[model samples]
Target: MMQAMTAAVAAMAFAISGQTAPGTTTRPVLSKAEAEPFTPETYLRYSGLYSAPVADPWRPKPIATGRPDYLVGGHGFASVQQAVNAAFRDGGAARRWIGVLPGTYTGTVFIPAGTPPLTIFGLGRPAEVRLEFTIDATVTPAVWAEQVNAAGRYAEGDPAWPMFRSCATKTSATAGLCATVVWAQSTDLQLKGLTITNTLLDTVDRGTHQALALRTDADRTQLENMRLISRQDTFLANADDVTRIARVSVRDTYLEGDTDFVFGRAAAVFTGTHFHLVSSRKAGGGVIFAPNTAPNYPYGFLVTHSRITADAAYQTAPTGYLGRAWDQGASATGYLPGSTPNGQLVIRDSLIGAGFNTVTPWASAATTARPFTARIDEGRDLNDVDHNRLWEHANRLTAAPAPAAGTTTSPGTRR
Candidate 1:
């Protein structure tokens, strides 16, 4: 078996239950009925290769709430995979609910297609419902293969290697080894009050360190009070290369990252959210959003009524930009597969902290000759109309830097 250090740490044990309002005088709640009244325990069965949870001293102990139709951390399912398997066993369209009890889940939780329309809600605050995973993109697949083969962690013909390879890109040498903490691919799904983090420890080499915190390709999806954290490519709201256009609405969420943190081709609406810049010292600053909206698409990223703030560390840099046009013809996949860069975004009625670059607000170039589209419509934005393809509508900057013609890497930088 591979050493514990090579693989993700183990975690388990939690239950889903409700709590009374603050300062409420209501009586104590009743103990949950572990077994459902009519549903067969067999009905909730699913098939998949099961990995035992490794022992991690820091991992939180599971909480056992006796709830039916719910998988508690410690008492019910040993892993979130099992719970998801059970939920999608029949692949029916009936509405179902999965309550995640307070505890940190450490592994990948995939919501596959054809699953029932489901709602996964955390029991407590976002912090309390934590789902964490780690995958360092700096490690090449050959290195991973050699290490895993030497460690003897996985047996021959195991699915781990193939799945790990699937995470990488066609051009990445470490292709098939990139890690995505959460992959949400089902439609009509809802996630509320959860913190999904990618704890890949490679802050030094930010180049190929593409640790994704969450990748959502679901349409008509809703995210409420979600805290998504990672270093690069933190949250991807995009569809598959062949799927239909993705539509998502994120409300009351918190997103933090460094390079192209919020980049995708989805028609996403972010409302009342907080975008934090957690760039490293060498990064100077980073771009927050990189949208690749097609010309025919009406909406791309509509960020309104949100706050963009920087940590004390990130404030040291000149400032970060709001977003850039993600249109790399050769590198672009997913929506608008090979189309020219036509990124559309609208930041309106938002409070941008002083940590942003007031001068060159958008990144002008990613490569030597490849510049972003210079004709981003101003629509009704109040800021100066000099910046290329990046328009703002009633946004406030803190540092208030002098205005400039174009930018090298001022507001947004290349990935």
Candidate 2:
């Protein structure tokens, strides 16, 4: 009996001290879920695995040049963009990774056609290396703004007679049309650990394309742990067509712009991200997720697990919306008058900070109880082809419960 009791106690001691469970031994098993402290590598690993899955069908291998010479001048490529071009153009190499060492390169990057999926991993997320540039529509390859035709299509023949000559380049409060870098057709372009910025924020003259640090016609891209800073139109997503679909995921990233800085018609998802609203301008143009869908697709925009801030400096009674359905040439397309009820926007499990216009909608007149033509069964909220429209407050925005408290975020929003 004594031997039996002694053996049982020994077994219990072994079970407790041998560390089958957590907190039992001096050195516990390091969970793959935990982040590494005080190390850039930890950020790299955390961002790599959790930020967002490569939205591409198949993630191409990382391109490694055997040596670091692909980096021009032994630091960054002759251009940050040239390195990107090399990675995607070369079909022979498997693991394609443009390892940008630490530095700031100034120039506009163009991701032309025939580029493949790319992953540009830097030393740390948006820290070790950076790309910054500025371009203006005033001095663009010659910009032209056209109106929609009778058939509700983009009319391309005429240009807006230059109203204001020479809109000087300066970071201002109003939104403009310039872009620092732009991409097209490319998918799964990963911007990891880099700071992309534009210094042109001054909107004194107005009616100019406020330069953007990053703009893309690219589809299905992911930005992780990157910082995007600009006053207006900081990030622009232009599409070749509204009907064709493009998906974007911005995870664990930071975006700070002055007025309506984030606007695009692309279907996008923002998760665990931060939005910075600046204070310089009285124009209350706020952040917006324009579901530029073709009034046909199901999902337009998805925002989950993110935070918004109207900069403390913005004291002039900021005048815009948390978001609004954009009117892309509504004055031209009678379609603009019919745009309100067609938007599909979802905001879940996210925190909406102030600088948001809570009283009135920032949506265009196209969204205010406009006439519906081919009206479907909308129950009662939409009844007439003339008077019924989408209710703006229909979705007041709410967050659903997560199972493990913080393991995963809500799904992407559809516009």
Candidate 3:
């Protein structure tokens, strides 16, 4: 067994269930009913591997009520901000735990500066009722990006104080462009057991813009059993060498998106998770991951012991990927000689359902600069866009050989 120390003091468990799905190139659907009841051995039967630091504690906290400057329900306060604000309000330094209840509270959440390194543990079983947020990019992109950026140690020292406001990326305007959800800039923050979903994507509500779900811009942040689902450009692991999602562990979670959903310049391990591909009209299935790594950056995305699935109709078209490095020559930040250099994305030892498009994976304009055309046509010839670069990885951990080249999951073949 590998040390599995992909995370510090951490053990990653990657497990899949049932059998393959019909029409798609992925494993079977998990039995939600049987999975609800947890046992020591089969705690995460539905999703396979279980992430500890589990939400075993419970406190029925009040919601949409209560004033700050007072601890509510448990620990610091009722609102996440209130609790965070109270922690650094007096500039006193100490770690604390914020216990949040299970509820579908909807609104934009901003984690500002002075955020103490802490843990937001849910009060119930997994996925009970998640605290979901939806915010517009044009309205608060800068504020969104600044919150996490504040927690970083800038070479310039201290960095700018965080505010729930926008900044300039377009025009002469200094406001909203890189908005994100639940950005934890402070180190040692651990969030376990919640569904963080519906994040506004890379597209701005007004025009060209960027959106994201949770961004661990600080070091030593842990998200255990939390589902990060969104459209394009979902989770941006911005922690680099100096910082990292340092010891970041995403265990037994589900990450879904359409185009380049998981992109960033950070190194993190994604173990025992299901990465689903949303639909795109183009011939190739939607691009699952596009990792933009800084040259000499030590880490990148490591996806293992999970399954890859796409929407029903597109399985034959090739949905999944061992991602190609996104080194767009003109991309301002990732501008490397001719392309952006990226750390490896090893999708290893897991099942690939039919939902994954098996053919023409690396056949995109990002690499070829021309529209894709199927030259090989249903033949195992040289015309197929070579996958040797994508599949022939040195670090990809292996579990089992995929069923076969063209095995489709049906009720009979599905276990």
Candidate 4:
């Protein structure tokens, strides 16, 4: 059995390395460029991803004020997964609230599709209710399944059992998808006042070890007053299908990491949030956002009225990069112009504190290493595939470094 699992993992890794493997579907590539020429009007159009009105008021209410259908910690369910399983058993279309009391809950939590809409919030402050685990991207799916199911939280008949099985059967190409502490695949899912951390910070080197705190692959996912702490690939706002639109909204949250921390293909909006770049990764600096928006998707990632700050170690020199285009699955030389996933991001009306390279904040593409080139000087379209699609408008830099608390000062003064 161990030998069979090892062979399966090896096959998956080989398949992920670009060879066509059985049961693996290749991402569709565009034969011709269909994207409209980007202009100020284009930016306005994409901004609708953030400006559009949402169905529900994406806010968190105190647990004391409302009655939660299920509870975790204290005299409640032994684990968050147990409470979620109970909610799944009492299946309904109506929203189910799960109030999590103060304490640290370890292990993976997978919220599968077809479950009732959920609002999982902490009773105390975000720090007081922590959900954390440590798993790097290099682990195979079989091994990951053993570790996650060691406590038997997900039984064979559990509602989330299939979800766990799906992740366990993933190949090396999708192994990173299994490293998340909280993987939410249900629409209208709300998480608030909690800290989801992946404690794989210093275990591995500052390489491609991706340990995600939270990964949302559903539409209308709302996160408020939450903290996602990790090192690489921390918070993934992803869509199950690249062709389908998935939207996520994060408000008043704190995300801390080093490289490509906030990344994915979802149309995600961050408002009044704080992004802290830890300097413990590499000597120079690290990247923050790595969006792999589809070729024709107008909306990618929008960060407005937020603060992107770095640690005090970067006070003397600027090294951090604002973002990079994640041309996923593209070879270093075989990247197609209109076919590959081009990341689109806009940082407007935000505070970009010190430690970022002012001259060239954006970096090269992740997979293809495509150089960052914007043609604003030549008045060319911003979304042109030839140039990187990262743009910033009305973003000011802070002359002062981050404070001792690791939060950036007010954006009142500009550099």
- TM values, all candidates: 0.68, 0.61, 0.60, 0.81
Model 3, backbone clash pairs (residues 3+ apart or across chains), number:
25
lDDT of 2 by residue, 1-415 (tens): 2243234223323211111112111111112221112121211121111113232242222222334324633545666666755655564434355666777766555554445555665664355466765555444332311110112122122111111121122344322443454434455576666777775555443333466777665565677767777665677754544545555667777777655566665656665676666655435555554444435333445555565545533323545455544445554444432442244444543454444554443444232323222222322222232332222211222222223554532111100
**Consecutive 10-residue window with the lowest summed lDDT within model 3:** 21-30
Deviating ranges (above 4 Å) for candidate 3: 1-78, 90-93, 112-114, 136-163, 166-177, 199-210, 240-247, 280-284, 316-322, 332-340, 363-415
Q: Candidate 1 vs candidate 4: which has greater TM-score?
A: 4
Candidate 2, residue 43: Cα displacement in angstroms equals 27
| Candidate 4, residue 168: lDDT | 87
Clashes of 4: 0
Judged by whole-model lDDT over C-alpha atoms, candidate 3 comes out at 0.46
Between the candidate structures 1 and 2, which one is better when assessed by lDDT? Answer: 1
Cα lDDT computed for each candidate against the true fold: 0.57, 0.46, 0.46, 0.74
C-alpha displacement of 133 in model 3, angstroms? 2.7
Q: Give the TM-score of candidate 3.
A: 0.60
Ranking by TM-score: 4, 1, 2, 3
Per-candidate total of colliding backbone pairs: 15, 36, 25, 0
lDDT of 1 by residue, 70-188 (tens): 56476878555556667877466776777788899877776766668767777777788888877655677665444323434333333333443454324566733235677777877
In angstroms, how far off is 357's CA in candidate 2? 2.3
Candidate 4 residue lDDT tens string, 205-311: 87789899999998878888788999899999998866666778787788988899999988787877778887776656699999998766656888876778777
Highest TM-score, which number? Answer: 4
